[model samples]
Target chain A: MSVLLVLLIVFGIGIVGFFIGRQRASARETGEVKVHSRAYYHGWWVFLVSVLPAVLFIVLWSAGSSIYLERSAQASLPAQTAESAVASRGLALSMVRGIATGLDRLDAQELQNLPQSYADLRSLLGSKGVALASEGQDYMVPIAERWHSQAATARTIGAGLAIALAVAGVIFGLSGIHPRARARNNVERIVLWGLLAASTIAILTTVGIIFSMLFQTINFFSVVSPWNFFFGTVWDPRFADAGSGGSQGQFGLIPLLAGTLYIAFVAMLFAVPVGLFAAIYMAEYATPKVRATVKPLLEILAGIPTIVYGFFALVTVGPFLRDLSAAISGGGGFIMAQSVLTAGLVMGIMLIPFVSSLSDDIITAVPRAMRDGSLGLGATRSETIKRVILPAALPGIVGALLLTASRAIGETMIVVLAAGVAARLTVNPFEAMTTITVKIVNQLTGDLEFNSPQTLVAFALGITLFFLTLAMNIFALYIVRKYREQYE
Target chain B: MNLMTERSLEKAVGDKMNAVASTNKMKGDKVSVFYGAKQALFDVDLDIPEKMVTALIGPSGCGKSTFLRSLNRMNDTIEGCRVTGQITLDGEDIYDPKIDVVELRARVGMVFQKPNPFPKSIYENVAYGPRIHGLAKSRHELDEIVESSLRRASLFEEVKDRLHDAGTGLSGGQQQRLCIARAIAVSPEVILMDEPCSALDPIATAKVEELIDELRQNYTIVIVTHSMQQAARVSQKTAMFHLGNLVEVGETEMMFTTPKEKRTQDYITGRFG
Candidate 1:
């Protein structure tokens, strides 16, 4: 009567139906009458027909039955308990379900000699390894008994219906197999639908994430004004206790936005020239043997997890810069150990592979004819690349740089570790600063009430960061598309 | 027997207007070319006459293009390609270590089979060579060089109004002429063309052919052509190749009429390629 057992039975029916359908289709292949599809196509078609509906029914039934049992158990609660706050009601229902499972373990004699009080019942369930919460009440005993019986009955009826559907599917599927059944087409259609469903699931999940963040952001805005949150330069979100009349404090976006853009700009400054030179060398100058070995090594730099890069920045590069500055300045270093410079340098290293890989592909895509034309005109290789190849590939390279910029902006771990969390709006690269992603992590980590502005602010930060990256990606795609049309 | 007599009669008529022999501008001595492990061109000797259009005619993959590319050392760009014999420009070994390839290419320019104008403005495309070589001292001089180069390529009058338009925006034949202008801007003594009219329509082909005839007065031109008729029409001297070997070399009229080799006869008369 369990879901697993029902699934196994459905699979068995499908296997049987497969053989029967294939045999029938093969028998129809006489001299005058031909089977339209291969025998295995008919077999697979029948197997899908017999299995799909039954599996769907089992999944739907289990979900529906659990909801029905919870509702019935809640209704059976005592009037005082039933009329409690929604949170307490939910707590009571969970206790009921747990007691129901514990009751199933009791023998027949123990069931007949049931406890009459909550304390005694708790002791009996405790002996059965089902530790009920201290909030358990006497009325839960009867409800648990009724809940257990209803679940059992629901499972029995679900198993019967699923088996009956599988049998009917087998009969109907085998009946369709004849001299001219287009089983191959039907099977292919089913596969197409399966692929579409997979893609739809991914799209739906993205939409769901957006909507969930949007609603919570709306909740956060109700507590804090949009104008103050957006335009205020300060970003001191004072964490207030629930139900206390304390200042909500500033939730300014400017410092974090500046930090994000400034760090990304610094990373681009370091990465663009180096990465572009590497790309050009690989595309135009490197021999085939060198290129074959070097490109993958560059990509392997991209494969290193961002968290490892964060550790490197925190432990190695930040201190090295601080010491180097101290040595040169002959005093306490102007650069902070955990500063925007540290994070930007490390993040630039992380972004180098991204820029180089995309740019290498873009630069190589410049037609060989372009190089020949320039070289034939007596231009040196560097001169040819400077005037002809680079100009043709400029749009694509810009698109790649924009994509890398978005990645640098959204980077979290490195900023959190290397760039200190104090959200300062300083222009100096030596000072510690924070970005939106780092702030989002900061706001959400500690123990707090979900509805508090402190917690809700995380959702607001998340949506803002999402939109910023989204805009950059859209612009990048636009440039890439415009570049593509130039060649074709 | 009748075809032989007819060829003999045509040869007698061609002998009346025999071409005057000219000094050799570029000479290939026992030239051989290889791509990786594959030998593309066998040892061959051919001379390109100064200020004359010498056409190389052959079937596809018969090393005609290979020999043409070798004339400008363009094969050096291809990976694993090797040229074993000496190619000299006015008795100077082009492949010598002392010679700068950039300088040699400046003096001996090339045009590809397909029109490959730089993705730049037409004026920029023409000025690119002159600017790189420092042929002009000032902007005015650069402008004058561009105008004269385009004029020599026969593209000046047509593209005079839109000198700043993208060179790639021009039609195929115009693009090829722009490439020719780009080559001529450097004022190379020798120009190599690799099937320059293969990508053009008949009208464009005629225009390029006419331009080639005019260009022969100042520049030594070596052209590789698949069309026997194109070779006969544009070239003063013609060399026939088959299977990576030179079959015959003589006046274009005599080579087309009374070919010395049977393979040359078969290729030109459409017996088999």
Candidate 2:
């Protein structure tokens, strides 16, 4: 919040300075003008001179004062508290953390005990002076008392300097903004820079996130070889020492990867045709009456929460599929409670509107004359639609499908709740399976181990998932470009 | 005159002199057009002819295009555009329960003001009709049909070699010719041209006018035009529509030279439309 305030103040100062400087400059430019430059330029010059130096001073002083305050506070500590070097350093660090986070809550008893502990430690370490100070202690008492007061004084002075800089900036800024002011242009430049800064911050944040993941994944890769992590057959995240333990644990990603692909493939199989057909029906075949009624009904599917889909998969589709599978196979357990089929089916339903809406927009964008050209030639309506409309809208539809795939790949909560914990490498949709996201949750939810392969593997999987989606996005973009070129 | 042209002229002028008089000249008796409950054409009554290219000319917002569309029931495709009209193609009521719209459109083909060509080869553009209608049995038969249609449209000599290229790559006039060829490939009895030369240059307009004269030999043509000169050049019979009413209908030369109605004379003499 203070950072924002500082920027706002600086901007105001710059604007004010511009106007004052412009007025001065304006007067100078014209023979009738008393000053050497435009009035607004003169105002800007004065504003820059007045505010910039003070802002710079405040920034330097505040940064320097923090370190100075901390060091002074430490140095002001009595010989009793410093006798034990490690203890004193730990206390100092804790004190700083407390100030920063507001987390340190020392009760009256604790505070009392701290001074006594320091005194005892001082005596034990053969330190001489016996000094204990309270917040109420006067400045004339001793070095410790004076130190505390000075620290408080420094904070107050730093705050006052900040306020003074801000006030000076505001006054100069207002004084500069007159009738002949160039303050608006100065404001515009500041706004442009502010936008640049904001975008840079967003980019820097993304880079920071990526590097943070990369470092942890590098740690994970050191513990588990990259080849084994990428291509091993089994997926057992648990690691047991073979020398001490009765049985060794397995760790392989093939099952998870296979499960994810199978689930997503099933989802796409259900989603693409249904969604695209819906889009086609809406865009081409349906009358206005039917379209008006049906379009919103279909779009309403997009608004339903994915969590609701998860519940539906768990409670409704799971049982339905189980019964259907049993009827077909003459057995009940062929359809597990948390089977890929249930999750895939529900996810497909959830994704229908996303695909349909996007594809509908693209399909509708196709010129009506394309259909007319075919229809005018005595082609049946269906024939025209199949040959002309579908072919023209194919690229956009494919792009929508790829985007749906990316959504399915990154889907976390639905799969976590509905997809089973078991990871199996199989094509049978009835079988239970896990995905990368589910495994990441399982590994990282509890007490985190920075060095453990189990925990670090989550970051590795995250990076892999990121790349997968990145590839999908690029492919979608390529298709969109290709489709645009066809029309253009 | 050819066998078809002579028969059509005799049937149009002789059989329908005062066919139904004031009410029956245009046999669109039960016409009712709806654009989502906003009726654009209301029970329209008019007479269309056999051999002549009847020009349906009117000011803007007069439902001229709507009435023109109802001739072949083209309004059927527009959503919520319900029509209840007894439109006939050569005395056979087109809006009958049994008449197929697909066949009706093929029988009464249309050309829009804008030259809309398919993003396909010029050959494909001409061949699309015969291929769908199965007018030709072999590639050779199809090729001959395409050539004749293009020739009839007066575009064969210019575009014969480049028929393999996209139809849309042609110039505006050439594209319109390509569209005409496409329309002619099906060999419809009546060709409806909705201001065909509106998007063409003067030279292209002359070429299209010359083609229209040649095509008048076989096909009964209905044209909608904003230009009176275009109507005078191409049309044999003229129908003047205003505010969704048939203001006048007469032979083109008589209508231009000596109109009976004051509005018609005023319109011809460059007065307010």
Candidate 3:
């Protein structure tokens, strides 16, 4: 039986169990003693009990049967095929499974009158839409018949077991639906476990990603010395010919690191004051009508995709800056079309909402009494905000800015489109530079050998970027927590 | 409106009896206040005598705090709050267009119900007002003003050694006193206190009451209190309010002993709020 059919049968059983449990509990409610839980709770409790274990069994059975079929086919392999490489052995097993599936589609008369020769069997299976890659051997026909029978038996046993479990679960669940049964508690515990499992999956996925990248990064370090990869200034990872011994170019991290930091620094320098002023205006000075309209309009800037911003940079802002520079200098422009300034400017615009929205919330959280105290002391509104409100919200604002800085460092789409992929160690903001994320994308794209240091170096760069942002986030969290205790 | 006119007529008679006793320092003439569309204070007239603690006592939501906030124009900070009629300080209409609110507030400082100290060193909290107003010319002079203001607030002895510590680090009573000192640093002609001791324990409340009585000798003070005993203990004159109108105004002893208005009598006797 198909997995979906089994699942549907189990769900139908659960629905029946729900009604039975609810009816039993309601019947008990007619007595003098009151039911501990509501009828709905009793129904849900029965549904969970009937459905959860059966669905779990069906899933495991389906997974286990596939592994068993593959192993049996591997054991039935001919001596010459078994002695072949692992890749060929895998290919042969897939062909065996395919022939088994094709045979199941044939009628009883066709199965009884099977082809005897290898070529004839191939032709018959091919006619049935199962195209085998290699020439078939003489032992394949018998093995395909055997594999088909085993798969059928496995499916039959699995369907029988799942149905039995579901029926037993319904009986056991209805038996517990008495007046004093703690149905609600049981259902609530199941919900708690479900939520915990969801969060655990998310956390486990993050850990799994880190470990996968860590192993590849270790492999890359084995090829390139850590000292050279970290401290080297040049980032000339020349693409060597595949499978040919040639020069593996330098993979210095300094220029990329400098570009990342420099661009982020410039973006912060542009964003902080503007975003902070906007936040102050929204939180302190604007009337409710004006604030209600302005806040969402600013958030709309955040809703825009970064790739669209990249397109804007590539098509409009970069050229505009270059032309403006050319007009002033009266020569080939000193500023390149794709330069650090272009990327930083666009990235700064993207980060404004990040800083403003967070800082606006933090500033508004300062008690209204604080404003009154300052105004009561004869300070002007500006004076009150300067000495009282801003100082109170400083730590939270710092944390917000740190988060914005991390976002700027990790930004790739705008930099890839606006900033040229030139790894240069320069301080000039008008010149082109590249960051770590841009280099990671460059190294991994296109056809390349997986074992090459060029591709493996992407993993190293990814882990480095991860740790850099991780440290900043941790520091920001520490600052936010330490100062949050002051007001409350 | 009829009830307001009748109460004001009674208040007029009381004012005439005390006219010769003391000159008016700050006078509210038929003042009314509105928040959005809701009228919070009706046409009310009262006078704050100079260098005396004139307490405004009323039940919750009776507009006593509203009246006190209007004296210093603190209500202007609240959006949609409106005040009409006249409030004059030393014979000048404070609501006149020519008056600068910042300067007017400099002459009339206020303390709120809750202690709200700036998140700064205790020294900065007091010096903030003087520094902004340029009341002191040099660092030494600013120090002297800070020290003398803290002294007048009666918190100098407790906080003199840790003047550089955060004002928010103080206890509830100390924080309230620190706020009082910050207000005093501006050297305003009048001081408004809105339930200043409500957040304190009994012992702290008693200390603050004693400080208020001492402060009356230097500045004109108007205090709003829920506790009738606090009004009687710390104020020279007491004004009773009910439902946004002034029920009676008289000497503290007479108002407590034999109130002319039944509302004031019932309230002071704890018959009902």
Candidate 4:
């Protein structure tokens, strides 16, 4: 429902309640019988009181209720269907778990045991009803079966409570905007706090992400010293004991960090000049009609999802780059599908709009008077723009470039797909590389052992990425503020 | 005549007459102006003499400033403003396509009502025109031009030591003098002052008036002022414009003491400015 419509309804109710309350009090205050407040204030106060709780409840319910409903609907299936479904689902779960544990991969019989074991479990669970009826048992079942039944019951109840709680939230939210509401003032306060909170959220989230990584990194450092992670040349993060049964890992992070920076730098080199020039043309040279058509078209580039860009990089840019590198290098050892250049070019395409839109705004904000003043001195239009307007807007443009740099550094998907998983610290754009984010995804996707060096290294990489972006943002903001002060 | 009809008639006539008159040995003539659909100057006729200060004194909305702007073609920059009548400098049509506006503006310089010295050092402000127009070939020549211009404006004594300070950092009177110095640096034949001392105090006004007398020996000056006393004190020729028409034009002493038109007399006597 529209927020305005909701407020109007609440206001109507509040007005009616206010008159009723005022009428009750008026007889006591004034013998001749008058309303307690100016009719509007009374109406406003009543609306203010009821609407807040109603709105809060509605918002909470909207966000949280649907998940509970899906579970509840699952739980309330018919008894026969439930028994059959649970048996089949249990069979499926065991199969998944068996594959996950690598148990089924051991031998032919072990793999073949997957189907047999599932059938046995299914028959065992499904036969419980017959056994209970035939044995004439009222409530005495085996402890294991009883425990399972209790668990199922508890799941159902939990699902119902979640649904009800969500519904209750909706009711409370709607009630907030009702006639006796104090919500106008409450909402105003919330909006003010919300704006402050939103600004804080960016900083807080950065800190939270960094800390999450730091804690895990600390765990990694406990096993391998910090010095090895920071400076060791080799990054063989798979150190398996020869006599032992499982995975091996080594924890050198320098190669990965170098690869990340190299790829990011290459991407910026591709993006910055093209984006800045495009921004200058759009802001200063283009007519309004052309700008209106082109600006949104540029923004559309930004609107495309990163995942889509990643796919494009993989399917299109990768092969094209590989062929081009082969042609350029005369087929020596320059395979280019998993190269820094491929990732940089794709990432540059992703960043073009980010840089252009920001710099365009900064350039456009340059005052018209500066241009006029120069032109008045008989300077040509281009000369005026070059000497006066560009110089004045330079600091702001630098800030915009810094923001784009931060975005480029933090980007993950394009780098992941086009820039392959070979993490070699090479300056050559034709060489394959990996970034911190791609490594983090690889480390955490499987049945991750939290304390293992491989898993813990992901966290350390995340911390480094977070700090770099945070520093970029803070410095960019400082430069932009200082530039504004100069003009003002 | 009423203001509206006078403007409407001027708009109908156009700027060709002013152009022809200018080329035929008149300094400035027949200038008509329009701001969008509303006309401000009629096909007005006037001759501002060489090497003498000409005072244009009239009631508000009498097209005095409009006519003043036409002398230098400053009205060309105002959006939706159209000038139909011609104006000339030294028997050359200023509005002619062949005339370069930049060169014309340098030849016929103007100082506005407000003291608009650029936000720069006083020396730089004075040097702006000379540097841009390539009037001074070297640093020594530029320095000489700047010193002479400031001396001519009578601002050299007060600001000689602080030539590097921002012009805007000076007091209002000093800034006005600085602007005058800046205008004179280009060494134009005609100098247009639009209520130059209206923003200055009495002492500054007297100083500027004295400087105007001194400037008359070398340049033709046209001053637009509201003050009758200042007009009487500074000008040799006075042109009284009323309702966009030139009511009377003659020697300043003769026009003031014995105006031929009743409107001119009424205005000069301070009945209705």
Q: How close to the true structure is residue A467 of candidate 1, measured as C-alpha lDDT?
A: 93
Model 1 bad stretches (over 4 Å): A15-36, A82-87, A101-129, A240-243, A483-485, B1-19
Global local distance difference test of model 4: 0.69
Ranked by DockQ from best down, the candidates are 1, 3, 2, 4
Q: Kindly indicate the candidate among 1 and 4 with the higher DockQ.
A: 1
On residues A217-304, what C-alpha lDDT tens digit does candidate 2 reach at each position? 8987887888888888788866444234344345577888887877888888888889988988998888878989999999999898
- Residue-level lDDT tens digits of model 4 in A200-308: 9998986887777788878878877878877876777663442243545566677777877888888889888888888888987787778999999999999999989
The lDDT, on a scale of 0 to 1, for candidate 3 is 0.89
Each prediction's total of clashing residue pairs, residues at least 3 apart in sequence or on different chains, is: 0, 35, 0, 43
Model 2 DockQ class = acceptable
List the lowest-lDDT window of 10 residues for candidate 4 chain B.
Answer: B15-24
lDDT of 2 by residue, B162-255 (tens): 8899787888898898889999999987788888888899999988888887787677778898888777766767777766666787876667
Model 4, total clashes? 43
- What is the fnat of model 1 with respect to the true interface contacts? 0.67
Model 3 lDDT per residue over A366-398, tens place: 999999988988889999999889999999999
lDDT of 1 by residue, A1-488 (tens): 67899999999999999999888888878858766899889988999998999999999999999999998788777778756542477788888898888887888788888896767988998988878877677888888888878888999999999999999998999989887899999999999999999999999998999999999999999999999889989998877654475787789999999999988888888999889999999999999999999999999989999999999999999999999999999999999999989999999999999999999999999999999988887889999999889999998999999999999999999999999999888999999999999999988888778888888888998999989999999999998887652542
**Candidate 1 local Cα displacement, residue A454, angstroms:** 1.0
lDDT-wise, the better of 1 and 4 is 1
Query: TM-score, chain B only, every model?
Result: 0.93, 0.87, 0.92, 0.90
- Estimate, for each residue in B139-174, the C-alpha lDDT of model 3 and write its tens digit: 999999999999999999999999999998999999
Residue B100 lDDT (model 4): 84
Off by over 4 Å in 3: A82-87, A94-149, B1-20
